[model samples]
Target: MKPRFYDLSMPLSEKTAPFPLDTPFSRVETMRMEDGDACNVTVITMSVHVGTHVDAPYHYDEQGLRIDEVALERYIGKANVFTVYPREVDGIPIITADDVRELSISAERVLLHTETYPEYAAFHANFASIEPDAIDVLAERGVRLIGVDVPSVDKATSKTLPAHKRCREREILILENLRLEHVPDGDYELIALPLRIAGGDASPVRAVLRMYAETKDMT
Candidate 1:
C-alpha cells in the first residue's frame, strides 16, 4: 500500500514569527539575476528555533548532547499523532498530565496538534503549552520524542521552563512550532531531521509524516 505524506514544517521567511525577543527570519538577495549578477544568491538570517525545529538535549541540559551529537535514528521513525486543545487552568491554557495520559500512544514519537499559534506571520503569547506533569506522563509512557504545534512546551512568559527541564530529565527530544493543523491524529512514519550544527542548541527541520493506506486498483 502506498502512503500519504504530510508536510509538518512551517515556511520560513521574513513573515515567519520569531519567539519573543528572538531574531526574526529574514532573507536578502545578495546577487539577483535581474541585477546583472551571475546568479541569484540569497542570504538568510534567523534563530535556529524560529520555525519548525528540533531541540537537542543541550538546549536545556548543559551536559547533554549537541545537535550534531544526537543520533539521526531518533529523528526518523514511527510516530503517533494526537490532537489536544488545552483547557484553561488558572487563566492559562495548558495540557495537563491527565490530558497526556488520555492519548493511546504506540510509537516512540508523539505529535500533538493544538490549534493555538496557527500562523507563522505573528507571534501569540497565549498559545497552549504543556505542563511538567504532562512531560512526565509522556516519558512514563515510553515516549522518546514529543512534538507540539505551539512555539514551546512551556509558557511564553516562563523563565524557569519547568516543562523543558522535565523533558531534559526524562531524556526526551522536543520538536516545536510544527505545522500540524492539517494533519489528522493517527500512527504515521515521521521524518524530521535537524541540521548537524556543531554545538548548536536547536535547528529547523523539514518535518514530514507518512500514513499507510489501502491501494486502489485503477482497473
Candidate 2:
C-alpha cells in the first residue's frame, strides 16, 4: 500500500497569530493579472518564527549555528508523536519532565501534541510550555529535535527562555506552532525542512508526516 502523508504545519497568512510583538505575515501584490499585468507577483513579509517554523540554535546563542548551517538530516527522520494533556502549576500550564518521562520516546524526533494553541488566528498566553527539565529529559533520551503545538517552547511571559536555552545546550532543534490536532499519536516519518536563510536565527517550515508501518519497515 502507498504511504499516507499528513500536513503538520499551520497555514501562514495575515490572520495567523504570531508571537507577541513579532511581525505577522503580510503580502503585497507587485503585479496582478486583473490589473493588466502579465502575471501575478507578490512580496511576502513576516518573521522567520511566524506560523509553523523551526528555531535554529542561533535564536538563543550568539555563537550558535544559523538556519542555513544546520543539517537537513536533523529535520527529516523517524519521529514519535505523543499527546500530553496540559497541567497547571501556579496557574501556568506546563509540560513537566514527568510528563515526558512517561512517553515511549523511541525516535530521535518527538512531537508533543498539547492542543494548547489550537486556533491559528488567536494567541493564547497560557499555552502549555515545555519545562526546562523536560528538555533535559528529552536530550538524555537521544532526542535530536522537539516539535510542539504552540508558538514557543517557553512560556509567553518568559524572558530568559530556559527551555529554549536548554535545547540549544543539548544541540536539539525546535519546531513550533505545528498543527497536530488531526494527527494521532504514533510513529511517523517527519519531513520539516527549514528554508536556507543566510545568517537566519530561525526559518519557517512546511512540516509534514508520513504514516509509518512496521510491516513495510518505513523509517
Candidate 3:
C-alpha cells in the first residue's frame, strides 16, 4: 500500500485565529442555498498572508514577481524538513547560518519545522522566526523555496525584515504557517500549491509531503 499524505495547514473558519494584530478572517455569504438559492456560496475577505500561505517576491520587492508570475515548479519538488527548537528567535536573534550549516540540506525546498505547534494554533504572541543570516545562507546556496512553521519569517515587531528581503531579492519562494510536528527531518516529495491570484503578493497554500519507501530493486 502507498503511504498516505499528511496535510500541514490550519483550518480556516470564522472562529479561526490569525496572527496578533492582523484582522480576523471572515467568510460572508454572497449566495445561500437556504434562501432558495441555486447554490451555497460565500465570498472570502481576508489577508492573503493570514493562514498557511506562500509569499511571492512581490511581497517585499516592488519589482519582484507576483503570485501569478511564479512558475509551477517552484512549489512542487523534493523538500527537506529540518526541525529546530529555538527558545527565542525573535528580532535580530534568530535562525543563524551556523544553525543551517548543521542541517544536511540538499533539496530546493527547505521546510523548517519549529516545535511551535499547538501553541500557535490559536492566537498567540511571538512565533519562532528565521534570522537574516540564515536567509543569506539559503540565498547563497541557490535554494528555490524556504518554508517555515510560523507566520512570518522575521519577528512580529520587525520594521525592516532582512530575511524577507534576502529571499525576495533572489526570487526564492516563501511558504509559511505549516504544521510540521507530524513531519520529521528527512527527505520527502513536497507538494505545496498556492492560489493563482492575479498580482497577489501572497496566497494561502495546502502543503503536504509524500514519503518514499526504500525499494529492493535499488540494490
Better of 2 and 3 by TM-score: 2
Q: Model 2, stretches more than 4 Å misplaced? A: 1-3, 214-219
Best by lDDT: 2
| Local accuracy of candidate 1 as per-residue lDDT tens digits, 125-205 | 888889899999899899999999989999999999898889899989999999987887888888999998999999999
Local error of candidate 3 at residue 101 (angstroms):
0.7
User: Each prediction's Cα lDDT score?
Assistant: 0.89, 0.92, 0.77
The stretch of ten residues in a row with the least summed lDDT in candidate 2 is: 210-219
Give the C-alpha miss distance for residue 190 in model 3, angstroms.
1.3
Better structure of 2 and 3 per lDDT: 2
Tell me the TM-score of each prediction against the true structure.
0.94, 0.96, 0.88
Residue 185, model 2, lDDT:
94
TM-score of 3: 0.88
lDDT of 3: 0.77
Error of 1 at 164 (Å): 0.7
